[model samples]
Target: MEQRTHRSEVMLSESFMYDGVIIALIISVANNLYDLGVLDLANEFILILIIWYGIIEHFIRNSNVINFDIRYRLLFYTTLLGGAALNTIVYKTYGISYIPIIIAPMIITLLVDYEFGASAGLILSLSTAFHHHDFFMFLHLFPQVFISTYLLKNTKNRIQVAKAGLISGIVSLVMILLQEPVRHFYFSMRDYIVIFLNPIFSSIAVVGILPYIEITTRIYSNIGLAEIATINHPLLKTLSLHAPGTYQHSLRVAELAEHAAESIGANSVLVRACALYHDIGKIRNPEFFVENLKSPEENPHNTLPPDVSKNIIMKHVTDGIEIARKNRLPIQIELAIPQ
Candidate 1:
């Protein structure tokens, strides 16, 4: 199974590279006016870097956790490189530019992870300082972008992202005061609003849409945690009311299986899942199970010989599997049922 998963990843890489390049190319060329003399050169370099790192790097060396849909990777590759490309175009065509400014970090944050985004933002912010020779403003934005993006790392929901943004805005206020000349080129009083709002809106945007993204991908970002919790889900509420003994047994087995997983370095998720529904078979004959008997009800095999009674008990395992399958439980849960 591991080998099968590996092959799937490898195949995906091979098929996706061409698409990544095309995405980079399209985004890079868009609104990028080549007629600009000095800015044109800068744009080319930035575009190349985005492609080399975002798309090519992933293609040549697969990341442990980070990845792109072959085609989508293309879009991201160009978007970043293209931001530089577009920046150059704007500067050359009309001299209105935020290429190396606002758009750069957004590109980095969307395509790469947070740390990478911060580094990219810091680099660009520093480059601006070099171009205009203002070390103070350069220093201010560099650390601010790093701190803001870093705080935003691993953000799964909008509320948390917004919190980070809020914190960032607060920090920006401090940075502004510390910078001395309150009348500097920045927004002054408005700087406070921008600093706080940038993160708030950005975090909100990501948080608002993350669920739909997860659903479309069918990717279990935290499948292990969620899967284990589901075994005891309220659907089992019905099971508890109807087969209380079975519920208790399943719970105990799940606990034991968790211990076994620690002992063997096995897939703990699968073990926990197996333990949860191992005795779904008992649901078929609740009366036969001791816990479900309202009143010391007579055993069906009370008059049978020991060997005959044992066979009846054994039949429940097979019976449980049918129930699990009938309900369309996950394969891991279904397979974990008693043999």
Candidate 2:
């Protein structure tokens, strides 16, 4: 109970810190816009405060949609802010058509989920449109954002990401042409190419940088999950060699959990990955575990008191967490070790 209380306090402190960081980022961005002469300090600043309030309220109301974990929240908000900053810089330097509007949505979709991706895309589009005072920017960006997110659902490979980007680029090109029909026809060929290829190049850039993001954030995308879920992973290979029975059990559990997750419309790949690593702690004391014991007489628990055996069994949870951290496993997989 005391531990739980301490944890709660820590979480509350983290929440306060997260809130401070978010507000600071928002103010910084607003001040930057003000300096750029894009925002009128009188009315637009008030409007931004209102928008920030709405965003906080939305997050509070849908806490499950946006994870409470500090890392996840920081990543989500930072990605949005970064996207907005990039958009602003690119818009000033290369014009609105050259803004990589799909970057935030695509990266969030691949790293988190469709819901988060879509939400980020909406917020980004709304904010960008307001900044530029152009409703057409929202119309132009929102559709491609949605398209890129939808196309990249359950993405398993780099090729799929590139493909989604290509499709989004095509959609963006169509929206651009439709937005100003007569003006677009008068556009130079280079202008058309820039507008169409912006999303594609942005996506390719995401593909190149995704591994680094995953490494820095410790949040694995489906692509990363897929790679770690394979049997050839170092930890799995070690588990197979040291605790064959537990390794086999993990395989069976992974299969069942994956099927169950799919039936419930959950992330089966994540489920499978978690299930595979759930029993990894047994590798430390393979002989103590029933699955790894060669015979009934080989049960080490037989020589220990009930309380001692129970403690030993429960120790696996902490041990697993230590191993997971040492291996730099995804937090989801580490969390599943206890359950």
Candidate 3:
């Protein structure tokens, strides 16, 4: 019952935040269009709002990506709103900007996952097309964005991220050349450089900013996860020293859960991380548990009444919560400690 209530509170909080983001997106888009001198303000705004809500409901909420931590949800909306706003300002000034399609999609893919990133790519591409009334732009941009998101889904390092960006750039270059083969024949070095360097530079920026984003948002990239999984982590080392049996149990559970998650097509990173830290509370009273008992005579629970033993065993869960909170563990890891 407690767990259910906690889950309900989390859901409600997320729902409220979700609604707020949706409102922000609407306001940002509507203001952009207004600044661009959109005619028929009432009808156009209403139509756009309806369409935006439908897309978000279908692609975000229904797809289950909205259930991610609130920080990630905020990231997604910020990327979308900021990208749209930038695209609008650039289009009003120059003609086009690849910021929305290239850089934004890359970050989303690496931070969130490929599926949500791809969804954002498509939605943003379509929104760009509608905003500019250039359907061809949609055809030109979607493929590159999709390719970047799909390719970078497994990236674990900066080099890999850059490689994915370059690959996506190559795809974009091919699409550009195919659209007008005759124009490239007369194109100067400056034109070629401008077109080709966009993706590469955008990719570099993504890699540079990723660490800052991870720090601020408390979201772990694959690189961040690897860093924590090492024995040198403070909490893990303490667990090994104070509760060796629990440490070994966690290791075995992590190994088995990792394999099972991989076999069933679940997120192995999440499952393994949870398994590794689930019994961290046992460190608080190592000698009280049977798994850590040094001898039959050393079993402390044997001298206690049934009720007292049960309460003592239950205390580990609360102790784990305290430890996890103190260490500032990820919410997923903390949640798994009880189970």
Candidate 4:
């Protein structure tokens, strides 16, 4: 009972920490927007807080994807709010360049998973529109931002990300031109150049920061998960050498899980990756496990009582968790170690 109470207290404390971080981000963005003259001091700043929190609450209530993983929740708000903050600073420093606005979706989508990425883009678009009170800018940018999520949804490498950028550039350029009708608008070379270059440059910038973003977040985008699922990973190599039977078991489990996940509209790549590393703990007691034993007659558990054997069998869950943590596997993969 006392242990359970302690665990509850710990969970509450962590929840407080999470809320505190999100609140700080909100205030920082709000304060910066006011400082930049985008929001009036007294009313708009407070209103922005209310609206922003409302959006977050709505998102939390509706989103299973972000809510399922604490890391995703944190990363979602951080990227969304952080992008808003950067937009303010850039807009303040440079008169009204839409560079930050153009690139915000790519960064957010690349950092968080697609579902959060799509949601964040829409949130950012609304926040940016409200900040400047420019509904047309919102109209102009929102579609591209939303479109970017779809483009990057299945991306598997830098080249694919770059290709997503190319598509975004084309789509954004069309939107820009369509909104400002060519028949009525005067086209300066500089104006034409800005329209063409904004998304192109944004894509290049996204590609440039992709590696650093992956390292910092450690939350694999679908593509990143695929990349990490390779057989050459050091932990898999250790499993192959130290516990061959367990290694083969992992491979078979991965195949079965991947197939099942695909049939059910789940994340097959993620499921397969988790399955591959699920039994890493057996590396420590390879000879004791039935599957890894050299001789079927040399039964280790048969010599032990039921309780002791049960304890030994259960210890692998804890052991696998430890190994997963030490190796810095993503939380999703580590979470599957027990089952």
Candidate 5:
């Protein structure tokens, strides 16, 4: 056990080192691309350090709430890097107003939670704003980031995502109007369209790519959970056909668990999804379980010795685990099976 613990510590140190190298590369590339002076580069590095500290602090504080594993770290950095790159490209090509500032925050919020999303938004907004010396752009984007993340909380459908985007766009339009001096400012229709539609377009793009991100990362959003928890899912359908009693029981458990989870401010969608699949192992020998047994006379336990019956019943946990793994369910659902 001591040796295993030491190995785990070494692996963790190596992962942090790897993350540091990636962050250094990102900073160097971004600074050079922007042709930032020494002071600006230093400021950017400081911002990166602050963001890094926040990530570590969040993981430490919320260890029980989230698994801050290598995969999650990768997801965080990938979103940051993607947002930075896109922001740079768009800012240089089109302009600052056209940059999709909400993409990183929205995606992070959907995949993880709003807190991380908010943090990510802060870093991206500050970095971009500082780079361009556009505090006004930062002011415009920062609130939109928070609003978009807030609106996207517990998102269960694509339409909700679009709605969040529309609302964010409206907020952006208001910000634009507020910033400009109405008496002196004259705006073209093109400017109005760009300011009003940027968030909406960015949101539509996020919706289009969200499924691919979920599939690739195996880190699902509530939308993905909603999809998998539907009656049409092959595993759920199989459970319903082969173990109707277990299926019905699962549905009831899901309903109860969902309500309980919601009351506790937990991820009710995820809880419900896990509950629906928790009994899938019983499908292997439906009659062995009392719930699936059509009658008391059909109880397999009565015919078997106590030890054998206990083993059969206990095997469901392992069976459920195997089935969950075979189906490539989310890690949360897979972990819930044994529990």
Candidate 6:
């Protein structure tokens, strides 16, 4: 009940903020469009893209959490503007070069969701396409974006994130492939340097910011990461203390799930997170599991039929989620528990 109230309050407070941001950004776009002269379709599209991205970002993705914390707000807005800014920089400085702007979106996609990242990428690309006054190149940008980002999903480690430079590089290559057979867009080797290498190097360097963000914010980013080390979290120590067997089970599950995710190209962070919570229900009945008790204690379920025992066992998933929610765990962590 307390948990549900907290959820309701958070929702009510954020409801206005999210609606307000969208409404404000829409007006801002209209104002900017009118001031810039409503003659050009390209400019009109950029305004539309901004609003669309704003709506999707704040209303859909971010509507879940409604706090006024500066760190995360900065994360959201920076990612929004950053994508557009990068695209503009790449296109203006080096013609037809999109790698510069895509650098941020690739990482943002991994840390966040493909939907948000995709919106960011589109807004940035379309912003550049319109701003540069090239409708053809602008409209044709989606192919590379789709192929590149899709392949990069399920990245859950530093090495992979650091290696996202590879993603951008591959995107550039895909863009090149899409442009096939006699499109001499860049002037020379130096221009190609910006076109090809900027995204690769930028992606690698840009991911470094994530750790700094994590450190300063102490937020998990829904990527299954947190600033809390082993000693910092109680559940880990409790698992080590009174529930060693459950601890071992969790470890095994984490290991297996992680491997399965890696093998099948699933989000390894999400899989590992689920493994951590898979047995949280057991915390309510630690001794019921064989390892916790020296003498087989009387099964409390002896008082009830198998159906009742099953209900009790199944209730832990909801119980664990409640505890997690009370602690303000990320939705990703909450998702780790069974439905």
Q: Pick the candidate with the highest lDDT.
A: 5
Model 4 error, position 259 (Å): 1.7
On residues 219-254, what C-alpha lDDT tens digit does candidate 2 reach at each position? 888889988999999999999999999999999999
Give per-residue CA lDDT, model 1, range 176-229, as digits (tens): 567768535545555465555554564454454444433433222223224434
- Alpha carbon lDDT of each predicted model: 0.54, 0.80, 0.70, 0.69, 0.81, 0.58
> What TM-score against the true fold does each predicted structure earn?
0.46, 0.87, 0.80, 0.81, 0.86, 0.58
Q: After superposition, how far is residue 272 of candidate 2 from its true place, in Å?
A: 0.1
Tens digit per residue, CA lDDT, model 6, 1-339 = 999999986885575456435533443343344235444544455465465646554555454432434344456556665555455444545456534655556655655556556655666556555554666555446544554456456555556654556655666655655664555554466654555676667666656666665544434543335232233467666665766788787878778987998798766666676677666656766766665665655556667789977887778778677766665554556665764
Off by over 4 Å in 5: 1-28, 34-39, 54-56, 63-65, 68-70, 182-187, 303-307
lDDT of 3 by residue, 71-114 (tens): 77788777766666665665566544334366777777777767
Rank candidates, TM-score, best first.
Answer: 2, 5, 4, 3, 6, 1
Task: Show model 3 residue runs off by greater than 4 Å.
Answer: 1-35, 40-55, 86-100, 154-159, 181-187
Give the poorly placed runs of model 1, Cα more than 4 Å off: 1-20, 29-51, 54-62, 67-149, 152-159, 171-188, 220-339
Candidate 5 lDDT, 92-113, residue by residue in tens? 8887668898998899889887
What's the lDDT for candidate 1? 0.54
Tens digit of per-residue lDDT, candidate 4, span 1-339: 999989976785566456645654574465355454533433344554565455544555466656567877677666666667776676666533354564656766665556556656666666566566776666766777777777886566677767766676677667767867744456566766665566677778877776566666666666667877879998899999999999999999999999999899887988988989889899888877888888888878878899998888888889999987787777777777765
Q: Give the TM-score comparing model 2 with the true structure, all chains together.
A: 0.87
